[model samples]
Target: MAKGGIKFKDSAAAYERLAADVAARRFAPVYLLMGEESYFIDALCDRLAATILDESQRAFGQITVYGRDTEAGQVINLCRQMPMSGDRQVVIVKEAQQMRGLDKLSLYTQQPSPTTVLVLCHKEKSADKRSAFYKGAAAHGAVLESVRPRDYEIAGWLAEHLRRQGLAADGKALSMLTDHLGTDLSKIANELRKLLVSLPEGTKRITDADIEANIGISKDFNNFELCKAVLARDMERSLRIAAHFARNPKDNPLLLTVMALFGQFRQLFLLNYLRWQSRHKGLPFPPDGELMRILRLNNPYALGELKQAAGEWPNRKVFAILGLLREYDAKSKGLNAGGMSDGELLRELLLKIFLL
Candidate 1:
């Protein structure tokens, strides 16, 4: 058991640490897991509860309390109490942002009991780093930091996770998964687990076909198909998928779809420009190969259609499309369009891309 403890500078780092801890069984005394991604924080808390704490001892000192429901002083009192029938006791506090008198808890954290493991789960965007509670936890206990995932890193994370689970997915499938799921690691992990379990053990590869069949998406309709259609300039198929996405907002969030599409386009555009460069004559387009070396990550599909698109359109047109994408990105968030339905927004963007 490695008890050196993992210090996550960001949310992705937090998940990686949690994954490692789950595998290694090195539980810490005070875990301050705070992040915007509720799923990761909640999952880590659940893992500790289910896998770490013993039942008889749980009754004596395994207390689960919410910040809104109890005061910080009360939690401190619970922590001060002795454990029963076990060498260690666990105390989990959810939504630590709502708890009152946390400043007092800060004072108590200076000398946290070795026998008690106090877990504070803070909600996303709510925990104040400047507050006494956060400072106290960092000063005295272990802190699991959480930072939002950048768009570029999400695809690689998905691929790496699949590899860890003894499963492989093609670049197309990986891209599609990230596109649909957004940058939520917890959700991505859950979906991948579902896919892994549905198949026989020791299954090594996952395809776009397998993903579509096992996941909630329809067999014939998905972001991958849509991207292919758009790249081929198949306006009819693009409209069909966009219309379906428009109808089912929950199944296909418009904002996420927009982000996914524009992200692909931006990457493609970058790849296309790289292809045009004599410096990259022997290099792959999209520069995925080069980027992987620079970023120290695995990504082989970087130079896909973007390089071709750059060659297909004049420099002016490519710049115009980029501008249009930026406008659409803002409009999807209701920034430019004060009042517009999701379907109408999708329809407008589709038309813009088609005409461009």
Candidate 2:
């Protein structure tokens, strides 16, 4: 197993090490997996529990405990015991964040048993970095910090996920999935798995049609397409899509639509600000690589449209549009909204954005 530094590591890097160790049967003394992103933590835990020992060995060697039902001292006691029927014992602590006096485990973490593989599944928050337990784990074992990916990064993540499954998705399909599913990795993964299962054998590519057919997301009238239409100032197409959304309020929640627009306009506002800085202050726009890195933009193709929009929309207009989005977002949440239907608010917001 790869060793961790005296600090937390990013989820991807941490999971890579955990996966490698599990695959090789190289057990670490302790694994402190903590974060808001539970998917990776749960996944690593499942793999460890399933792969560390054979069924017969596991019957005696594997121990699973819930933090709410156990204390740090009990966990420490369990970690100290010798394996009964195998070369090593696997002790998994799920929801470790709920364990009272988790800091008390510092004493045991300082010198964990080499024959014991202690797994801590701390969900929804990270361990305290300043705590002795965190330091001890980092020194003796490994710490994995799972974080939720941002909205713009989802498409890239989905694409990579599909690639791993021997399937590929185009930009439009990626956009449609992200737009509809938002940034919940678990949900997105589940939906993609369903799509993959629905496909014929040896079908390697996922297209808009596949998405539309399997996921029930429209290829032409989704929020992704709506954003493109509005950015291109294609009023007819933009209003048409908005009308579709207004009609299908159940699938296309008005709040989500407004938030999507808000995100789009916010991106445009940033692009406009960068362009202005480049022209007036002699500052350069970030290189494509840096721009994607800083902006969390996975698709470079979207940059072309963004660049064009940045040139077309002045800073003032971008600012105004942002303010309007904010207002409509509030109204969509029923803040100062005088009983207007979601469809009405959406239509009104679209008109105002188009005018801007």
Q: Which candidate leads in TM-score?
A: 2
After superposition, the stretches of candidate 1 with alpha carbons farther than 4 Å from their true spots are 1-10, 18-25, 126-132, 243-250, 272-288, 291-302, 334-344
lDDT of 1 by residue, 151-238 (tens): 6677766776677766688776787687778877778878877888897667688777777778866645667677667766789999
Off by over 4 Å in 2: 1-9, 277-295
Residue-wise lDDT of candidate 2 within 284-345, one digit each (tens)?
88998787666567778887778877767777987898898889889988898889888888
TM-score of 2: 0.89
The global Cα lDDT (0 to 1) of model 2 is 0.84
Best by lDDT: 2
Give the range where candidate 2 is weakest over 10 consecutive residues by summed lDDT.
1-10
* Model 2 steric clash pairs: none
What is each predicted model's overall lDDT from 0 to 1?
A: 0.71, 0.84
